[model samples]
Target: MTVRVSRVRQHSVWASLVSDDAQALRGWLLQLGFAEDLLIPGERVDAIHHCQLDWPEGGRILLSSTGERPTPCRPGTASLHVVTADPDAVLARATSLDARVVREIVDQTDYPSRDFTVADPDGNHWTFATFAG
Candidate 1:
């Protein structure tokens, strides 16, 4: 019995963001990155909840205005980690957006990675990092 398992092709990942200030968050995201709407029609930042933004490469962020956190962690908890080519660029953008930097950008010897954490306008934390060899 030699059955090999193959990995499935992932189309996109949906990151849900529950926030009271969905409009502000959406504005920040739009300024940072993500297109208005290309694939779907009427997918703008009009609704209070169920709003989504398409990423340039792949994946989309689902912004909900339910004011209910999805994760089981604390209220202001964001463990979002994004691996990118240039972390400094992302940090610059985040800085321009006036995002609160929880963890300054630095090279971590323990994890062998360069990363930084920033808190969004709605209190969600986002971590952008680059893994090094």
Candidate 2:
């Protein structure tokens, strides 16, 4: 038996969040293996007006600094779940960054997923899971 994987060329939906310190958040995302796709600088050198970080597997995350503009989403209130082939590796990187562990790695037999959750410096919850669904 053989399995084939399909590549995703474009993503239709993206997760967006507001961060008190978008520059710092961008660095954190990079440490977690997200590639910087685009960055729009704000008035201040450290302020980020907008940024797009792409996950290697698929999908991307959009973020902007709080008070940079009026946004509906509030900072530190986002909960993002990302699917990855190697959750353990991602977890290790997150651990090295000293990110707060919200939930330890757990194997869910019913759904058949191995995942863990952590909190970014902005207090956003990020869950890395092997399950794509």
Best by lDDT: 2
Residue lDDT tens for model 1, 28-65: 87776666552221234543545677756455676655
| Candidate 2 lowest-lDDT run of ten | 1-10
Scored against the true structure, residue 80 in model 1 reaches a CA lDDT of: 69
| Tens-digit per-residue lDDT, 23-110, candidate 2 | 8899999999999999999887788888999999999999888878787999899898898889999999999999999999989767
RMSD of 2: 4.4
Model 2 bad stretches (over 4 Å) = 1-11
Rate residue 104 of model 1 by lDDT.
Answer: 97
Give the least accurate 10-residue stretch of model 1, judged by summed lDDT.
Answer: 38-47
Candidate 1: C-alpha lDDT: 0.66
TM-score on alpha carbons, each prediction: 0.69, 0.89
